[model samples]
Target: MRAIRITEDHAIDVIEARVPALKQGEILVRPRACGICGTDLHILHHGFPGTCYPVTPGHEFSGHVVAVGQGTKGVREGDFVAVDPNVVCGECRWCRAGRPNLCLHLSPIGVGRAGAAAEYVAVPARNAFAVNEKIGAGVAALIEPLACAIHAVETAGRLRDRRVLVLGGGTMGMLIALASRKMGAGEITLADPVATKRAIATRIGIDKAVDPSALGDELFDVVFEAAGAVPALKQALTCVDKTGTLVQVGVHDVDVTVPINPFNVYEQEITIVGSNSLADKFAAATELMPDLQKEAETLIGEPFNIWDFAAAVESMAAGHAIKTQLVFD
Candidate 1:
């Protein structure tokens, strides 16, 4: 088997490796399509929390079940599935409370275990949700990110009839805006510096897409910062209406800090919240994908072969596509 490996010294290689042995309740999947995410970039260049060195870096993926381990239920050989990468310790307090994203021992597949940037990857059968084959592998691979977007919107509470603003026009931002619209947001505004991104957002049913500088004197009931950039976060903070909520959906450096007005937060009754990973929304995202198939399809760009992992990373870093993926031959 061929697997893309990222070492601790920031080296990437597509090396011949042994197929992963499935444990009890695990299934071995032959990944057909995998999406490279920002987290993969972090794991490659610097490092991301919980990343295991020499790891295979692909979390957003869908594949066929080639083999099922003993005791595995609900999944079978030849079943097409999209996987939930977050592997939690079900005995943890957060897990027991149904907030597995915050589990004390959360070890996501790509970050902490071997992931799907290979010919075959092993995952707990419970993490694999059967998806319609008609959706195609590219869109099925999007289910993971869509689940995260759903969790982000879920963190925002009520959105029906609320004015919503999403910062950024990347895959996560686009999905967040789409999710907001699905949740009955009265109006959706997406701000991105790139004209191409704004165009894509507009084409995908965003109510309004404009340059960040063009947004003047307008505030939103629910503001989402999904760009994972400090500048976008700063902009999102100011776009929230009084008594409204601001959802932080972006990943930031551990040491990074941005200035905020304590007075405004207190006097205006602003609620600030942080949304982590998908939580328990993977199944819901799988259920929602068929309805969102066309829209999701528009976000995907031409895919690179799984062996061209470096090129895919470079393309993603260059902002060449809204969603960059790898396809198995």
Candidate 2:
């Protein structure tokens, strides 16, 4: 089997490795497509929290089940499915509270354990969600991130008839905008520095997709900060209407900070919330796929084979691709 691993030295290399044997209640999946996320880049350059070294890094993936270990049920051989990478500790306080996304001991595939950036991956059978033929593996792979976006919107309280501004035009930003629109947001605006991303947002039916420099003084009922940069966060705070909600959906560096006036928050009663990874929204994301499929398809770039992992990373970093993915050729 061929696999891409990030060494302890943070160097990515391809290696010939023995196929992993399935454990009890696991499924052996031949990954059909795996999207490269920003976290993967963070892991490659230096480190990402909870990522053990020499890990195979791919979380957003869909594949065909080739075999199921004993006791596995609901999934079968040859079933096309998307894998939810987060494996939560069932006994954790957060899990017991029905907020497993914040499980104290969460192990995510591609981060804390071996992932699907290989010819085959052994995922717990329960993590696999079977998809119908109408959804290709490429688009189905987006279910994970879309689930995150759904969770973020849920954190935002309500979007119905609200003015929403997504402060980024990247893939996640676009997905957030799409989700907001579907939730009955009165108007959706996307702000991005990149023209290509803004254009893509416009193509996806956003009411407005504008350059950050050109974003006027219009206030929004809800602001979604998806860029994960301090500047974007600062701007998102300013874009929110009085007593509006600001949802931070992007992952940021631990050292990053933004300055804001304490009195402003007190005076406006602006609600600031943060959304982590997906919770129980994975199934909702899957159910919403028919509405999101067209735009989701547009967001993925040309697929590369697993061996071309470096190229995929380069494309994403260069901003030449939206959702660069690895696929079994």
RMSD to native for every prediction? 0.7, 1.0
lDDT of each: 0.93, 0.89
Give a tens-digit lDDT track for model 2, residues 214-307.
8778899999999998889988888788989999998898778888877888898999999998987888988898778889999988888888
TM-score of each: 0.99, 0.98
- For candidate 1, the lDDT comes to 0.93
Candidate 1 structure quality by residue, lDDT tens digits, 1-329 = 99999998988899999999889999999999999988998888778989888898899999999999999998989999999999999998899999999999998998899999999999999999999899999999999999999999999999999999999899999999998888898899999999999999988889999999998879899999998899998888888899999999888876789999999889889999999999999998999889889889999999999999999999999999999999998
What TM-score quantifies how close candidate 1 is to the native fold?
A: 0.99
